[model samples]
Target: MYAVLSVTDKTGIVEFGAGLRKLGASLVATSGTAGLLRDAGMDAAVIGDLSGVPEMMGGRVRAFHPSVFGGLLYRRGNASDEAEAHQHGIPRIDVLACNFKDLVADDGIAGALDSIDIGGPAMLRAAAKNFPSVLPVVDPADYGEVLRALGAAGGEVAAVDPAFRRSLAAKAFGRTCAYDRSIQRILDTTGDRE
Candidate 1:
């Protein structure tokens, strides 16, 4: 019924968010992404606003809170989980959209360090781990497919096949692996120079 978005790729996000809005889904996004959604005429709340934790460490730490993970990780049919979620005011996040910042060749150490996303991979993994309850989208290319699925199901991604959800999860893992490898390369290179 709700979704979270924290993406570096703005391509097609506006259209995707707008499509979701039409399906009556609320959006939670990082500050920068939220502003872009609003500019595109889709109302999106900042992720910090939902968790009541402002971005700290120069916007590097914001999405790892209980509220965010609880929403994505809660078991759909578990009464205990439901009770705990309600007690903590953790709303269910049916979808999570994120595309990590790409470390460009021209970007020096400063830029590469900043480009390494801490919360994004965590979010993607969580949502993928809880698929059927949460759909994790890590590529801009998948926007249309998601929107179409939402539209077909009248906003309920539960209608999607479990196989498809697994595929999505697999893709998310692949992306996270590549991202972590990139960060590792950076650390190795830095250490070499040191």
Candidate 2:
């Protein structure tokens, strides 16, 4: 199983990543996140490794690749999807653990603009949209519960309940919606002062 983790807020990420690794999940993470996981003594593949592009454009271009999205969004049962995925060498991303930078909490226009996360939200939404095949985890608090669920099923990703996956998808959508609203509000207020 493959788990993609690209969280800006690294509250309990190391422990969670370690737990996932112990459960036989290969971890693919953003550059900083991968470094942290490695420092914690857990090996994690960098997102760039999957994307075939080094993190460039001020590290903003990470995870905006077909390999990442294809892995998250590939349909399990569809023959064409399976063939395309195999053709592109896309591995299935069974789990996504991500959190966006908080635009609402930024102190100023510069901070807000800087906090506008693009790739993170896109990946989260893709995982959520494909929730039946991928587990979407937006909040750090959900880490323990997900680990427990996976553990209960002996690390089988498909063993997670459909209802639970739906709930996680809802949460992922909620977070992305709130994040977009925050960005809109900031832009609106910024324009008013201009």
Question: What's the CA RMSD for each of the models?
Answer: 1.8, 1.7
Tens-place lDDT per residue, model 1, 30-101, is: 998899998877889999888999999998899989999999999988999999999999988998998886
Off by over 4 Å in 1: 104-111, 192-194
**Cand. 2 Cα-lDDT:** 0.89
Instruction: Give the top-scoring candidate (TM-score).
Output: 2
Best by lDDT: 2
Per-prediction TM-score: 0.92, 0.93
Worst 10 residues of 2 by lDDT: 100-109
Please, what is the whole-model Cα lDDT of each candidate in the order they appear?
0.85, 0.89
Q: Which pairs clash in the backbone of model 1?
A: none
Which whole-number lDDT from 0 to 100 does residue 149 have in model 1? 77
| lDDT digits (tens) for residues 99-133 of candidate 2 | 97656644557767666889999999999999888
